[model samples]
Target: MKKIFTINCGSTSTKVAYFEDDKMMCKSSLTITAEQLKEMPKTLDQLEFRTNQVEDFLKENNLDPKDFDIVVSRAGTIPSVPYDGAYEVNELMIASVTYAPEAQHASTLSCLIADKLVKGLDVPVIIYDPTCVDSADEIAKITGIPEITNMPVAHLLNTKMAGITYAESMGKDYKDLNLIIVQLGGGITLGFHDHGRIADWVYDDEGPMSPQRAGAIPTRYLADYCYKSNKTLQEMRMYLCGQSGLVAYFGTQDVRDVEKLIDEGDEKAGLILKAMAYGVAKSIGQLCVVRGGNVDQIILTGGVAYSERITEWIKEKVSFIAPVTVIPGEREMEALAAGGLRVLNNEEQVHPYIYYPKGYSSIEDIINNPNELA
Candidate 1:
């Protein structure tokens, strides 16, 4: 029996799961409160603290790190990710992730945590469907501005798995089907799979507004807000991505609460819920044209997909394009384990980690001395 350990590092929490072969043995989530997070101001600083949390969980569950045959990790915005599939974690991956093009995030430390867990053991650590798994075609990458290119920064771990799951359910190969896979969570993303590759996409920031993200807003209005909001750049950033969506109106990201409010006859809540579904359906329609309305299925998967009102609203709008299938909840842990199993069974080709020439090798210098960059 092959033992697999998967780690998904979040903002202030670590989610881990153990699988013996294809069955999940146990799973856990280790969350850190705001006070505890204050101790590690830098993301990398939490590496040791979070790694210890995973160790404790394993120990408490009577699972040893040494006994695991392989370790799988969740990754985010690392320098050019190899998009074909699962990649073996390596030094180049670590170095590039530390350089982090945008803001440094906790999931960037996933490889670090995975490495620590399998320190002395001869185990392979692989990351599956990391953020920024760019597969958009040349035509899809174009923007009106020649200087800028549209890239696919998506919730690929869940979207890809959702497509595969549907393909298998229909007794068809993923490579032969044309699909529009929508990931509805705190942020929403739509990926258009042409054959096996993701040929087009409606990125979270450009697509539907979600529980946390504002998604697409008027460009002129947003540009005006940059000047008139009188808010710091960080605050403005939060407004665009973090503080917008449901949280902006209701101060909560949970759709269950919104639905409860609807149940209580809250008219405003019902309106916002319908608007969310409208935006999702509009994005689905946009992607449908990408393939000339030849889509086989439109699949919805993620936290928000659990909402019957939203999914049904989306289905109501886009059911003409293709049959809509709702597969609720995040399956990141299962996706990671499945990817690892594919690698172990030689069912998929494993790619080597590639580094960005313009990336940093280490954050060690800056971590110890904040003034170094200055």
Candidate 2:
């Protein structure tokens, strides 16, 4: 039996899980503070304050990275277009995430770990969704952003993990059933997975407005707001995704704090939370409709979905669409390890990732379009 070590990096934390002989033997999650993030550690010393506990846990468990057969992870990205799940990490992924046009701190950590592991270990290291952008040309043209066609299916792993777990719990294989997974994060993402593939997905550009995110706002209003604030497009984006959303609305990025305020009769807090739930329901409805309204279940995941209130609200909204199940916790690490195993065993075929220019759908469009860069 082989041992697999999975690492999942996020904006403020890192999660590691170890699987041996077909079972998860240990897991560690390390949380980091905003100040710690601001400093941007360039080495393991910089990561010390945050990961000291994790290092200690590993030491206590007598675990060694070198012992693992493979180290797998989900890499961060800049949003683009439609992509299928599963990919092998490459230099393109490394550069995209590490030197992303946008300053994505999560990507920084992923690269740091990837570099460290590949150099230190003899095992194979796989990054599934490292800033993948594989979009169809048609959608890219509509958005007028050529980079929109770069589609990385990062979410596929987590959604499928949730779906399979929920299905197995019900004595079924996910391949035989259709599932709609509503991930309530800074925004709400509705995805449909059927027969072992992602059929369709719709993400609220405004998100479910989390404790740290302001879900989608009216584009016009946002433009006006940015104008009034005299913020550039880059700054506006940073605020929209990183700062202004939930933190601006509620003064805290922790959903638990917001929920507490709501419990304390904070009307504004309650509204934002409800708004997120409504958005979630709406997205789920759209995905269900896309799947001909025969979704077997709606599985809710992500940080925000942990709240009982949010889950119940989304449940109420999706009750008519399908029976709803809330599977909290992001299973990114597990998915990566399992996916690596599947790919290694040749039990599944990894899809070829195609990076199409922003505005074209097919080869013809790319070749014939008058606007195409010559």
Query: With candidate 1 superimposed using the best TM-score fit, by how many Å does residue 255's alpha carbon deviate from the native?
Result: 0.4
Whole-structure CA lDDT of model 1? 0.81
Index of the highest-lDDT prediction = 1
Per-residue lDDT tens digits of candidate 2, residues 51-117?
4555565688898766777667665553353444455555444434433323434543554464455
Q: Which TM-score value belongs to model 1?
A: 0.90
True-vs-predicted CA distance for residue 61, candidate 2, Å? 4.3
lDDT digits (tens) for residues 48-163 of candidate 1? 89988998998899997878888989975575554757887876665455544354467777888998888777888888877777777778888899988776677778888888
The alpha-carbon lDDT assigned to residue 366 of candidate 2 equals 45
TM-score, every prediction: 0.90, 0.79
Residue 207 local lDDT, model 1:
79
